[model samples]
Target: MNRFLVLPLALPMVALAAEPAGQATTPLAGSDMAGQLGQLLLGLLLVIGLIFLLAWLLRRVQQLAPRGGQVIKLLASQSLGPRDRLVLVQVGNEQILLGLSAGRITPLHVLKEPVHLADAEPATPEFAQRLMELLGKDQKDKS
Candidate 1:
């Protein structure tokens, strides 16, 4: 009984081993280590090529259309609290209330002087330039 059971298991293994030695030693195309290595390298190169292509496309698109105001709200919302600086100037009976924050501040306009608040424009080129210069100076100072 034991011999019969052992024969069934051993016979298959013996038959497997009886195949030609050359056939057993031969490697399949898929199993070739160098082929696998080359395939892996090719896949990596393909990924890198795709990344460079995307970058080139993005650069071309950017060149074709120059865009601005991508993050105006982000920049405008940086200051959490009251973003505007309020200045109260009392000249005689009348009181001048001025708000200076972000795009409101200027270089030439004397914030120290107590002037009338009736004459004030929200959008001024001179004001914007002065504000830009002031912001640049502030950034430089911080850095």
Candidate 2:
């Protein structure tokens, strides 16, 4: 078993060593501007792909983030008492309560809002659709 494993691994190294010692190891033969530019473009493409992937993942995480008033209510009740200090934030139509106590902080509940999500600047469906389009364009460009 040891010989079988060792032989396979050793064979590649043996084959690599068989190449002439003085031969150059540059990826493409003939040093030219276009080849270097092509390599640079490939590297740039890889970086852009990684950035898009991260943005896509971030959007997914944001989409999956918790919503509704109940979760806020539970957190608030668990983390705050009657005398605790609290900050209420209202964005568009959503409200979040932040509780502050001596050496501790917690979320209290989501307050009722006068405004609704429908009035927000960027609607969820549009944002998701645009994100998908951008990702699709990126994939098409890659191909």
Candidate 3:
């Protein structure tokens, strides 16, 4: 009676432990690695996105931060020709007009009374303005 009951319980255990014939009992290692490849790419993209976000935030903060101890501030500017321009700069309480060309800068005059101008965007730098003008001229020539 003990032998009969033991065989019945042991038979099911043996069958459960046995793998089906002519088939893999475990998954391929390459397939497992391939599945993780997607996760790796996603993580890489997330890190790159985080870097870009931080860079953008840094730029924004720099724009909003106070610029202290600036000795000279550009108050006004006007282009004389292509390469020459007049720049008015504030140093302490005095405003001086300066002449800027390709190779040199000259102090033209020192104002007795400081000229006050409205708060506005400073004049675009020379290189950018010249580039745009050149591009515009090319287009005009083509037309």
Residue pairs of candidate 2 with colliding backbone atoms: 72-109, 76-108
TM-score of each: 0.32, 0.31, 0.50
Candidate 2: residue 54 lDDT (0-100): 100
Question: Which candidate tops lDDT?
Answer: 3
Off by over 4 Å in 1: 1-24, 27-31, 68-78, 81-143
Q: What would the per-residue lDDT of candidate 2 be over residues 43-67, giving only the tens digit for each residue? A: 9999999999999999899888776
Residue 54 alpha-carbon offset, candidate 3, angstroms = 1.8
Query: Per-residue lDDT of 1-143 in model 3, one digit per residue for the tens?
Result: 99999999999888876745423545675787887998999999999999999999998998897787788888888999999999999999999999999999999999999998866555554687879989999999999
Ranking by TM-score: 3, 1, 2
Error of 2 at 133 (Å): 20
Model 1 quality (TM-score): 0.32
Global Cα lDDT for candidate 1: 0.61
Write the number of the candidate with greater lDDT, choosing between 1 and 2: 2
How much is the lDDT of residue 117 in candidate 2? 40
Best by TM-score: 3
